[model samples]
Target: MELLFIERISTEQLEDLHRISVHTFRSNYGHLNTPENLQQHINQHLSKERLKTELEHPEMRFFFAWVDGKVVGYSKLNTGQGQTEDYGEDQLEIERIYVLEEYQGNGYGGALIQHAEQQAKTLGKSNIWLGVWEKNPRAIAFYEHIGFRKIGTHTFQVGQDPQTDWVMRLSL
Candidate 1:
């Protein structure tokens, strides 16, 4: 419980982010997606090259949580603009947030969410939001515990299946 040290991802940590993202995806979604599909999804969206490119983007923010110099998790943030946007005047969307399974029961997810809120606040955002898979009851409960309330629903593709997600929001 080292307070899950969190910070904005730096250029030097792109590879680490990619590595942790793959691990997170595998452990968290292996049951929901086939190996080949998971690999394809993660490789396309969470690869090192994609992280590097996004980190260099002007409108997105990425944060990482580390312990003993090893990244355990990360959350991606973005400014609201188009289609899938948050509801704040300066909305900061939690594009993604993850914690390794082994670290999940130790409050790391809470730390990450709090860190993301602070980061959003730092950017002048008054609210933060994210989408959680509808069937992920544990995740939905955790988000509610952290003060996020479901405001809407959206559909996502999970492998060859369609999935439901609840749009959750929190005031910063």
Candidate 2:
């Protein structure tokens, strides 16, 4: 198998991030959400304009995972005020990490997590954290297997549906 490559996302790659963000999101959650709700969520969060704004934000960073020159996954990390929750200045949040369905079960996800940790270390963060949807046992297990511990739970909104997310953290 070709090794997956990780790179920091550039402004020119915003549209690619948008595309993979939507594709991976829908592929993973479309079945559980109403079509209208899913579309609404996508439009609100993954639209090109919104992603551009996010990409321009100084405290947030985005990266892409590539295989044979094609984007196969992506991740978003937040620090300072960009963090979704107030976890302090020494913490970095893994706000988003998704691998395309075809790449699931491969090591891309782990590679992304390792990338996030390295980013955190570079930023002088002592801990890395993220909120995984409670219903996503697979993701939760992956995090746990990677040394993250469930510290708490929070509510996340996907259109009209309110979902619970397990707040997991790893001390570096």
Candidate 3:
């Protein structure tokens, strides 16, 4: 079945989006991080109020993919917002791109990335960037396969442990 795509989530969809985020995040990262940390991440990132606030942001936008009447994946992009000031006028960043485990490895991720890149181009951004956890080699490889180059790194705390992440980018 073809997935129906939603480019702008409506207010009514906020709760469903939050539910999807929590479910997808837990299933995808639960084994990769401590349960405590994973729980913390979900609490901070997937709350309905937080997501609604994000959607209300003037510079924030997201794309969602649904199949069989259920959302399976989503990707969000936000304008520089200080995160890409180093790269300046030509750059914007992907805030998040997630596909449920069952929907992964099926080209859904690539489609979303391509859509994000096009969105950046439409915004007149010359470059698009995203951050990836160091532990996710598969994700790194996938990004590279799609033309993202690793340019830098940053340290972040996932739950209670400090970890490094790679900054990857592609020219739009």
How would you encode candidate 1's per-residue C-alpha lDDT over 1-172 as one tens digit per residue? 8745788887797778888878887888888778777777777777788878888887777788888776778888888552145464577888789988777788778888888788788889887888899989999999998799998988766555567899988986
Alpha-carbon lDDT, every model: 0.80, 0.92, 0.80
What's the residue-level lDDT of 22 in candidate 3? 84
TM-score of 3: 0.90
**Tens digit of per-residue lDDT, candidate 2, span 52-85:** 9999999999999999988889999999999999
* Candidate 1 clashing pairs, residues 3+ apart or interchain: none
| CA lDDT for candidate 3 | 0.80
What lDDT would candidate 1 get against the real structure? 0.80
Window of ten residues with lowest summed lDDT in model 3: 80-89
Candidate no. 2 TM-score: 0.97
Clashing pairs in 3: none
Better of 2 and 3 by TM-score: 2
Candidate numbers, best TM-score first, in rank order: 2, 3, 1
Per-residue lDDT over 16-79 for candidate 3, one digit per residue giving the tens place of the 0 to 100 score: 7888778877876788889899877777767788888888777778678777777779988878
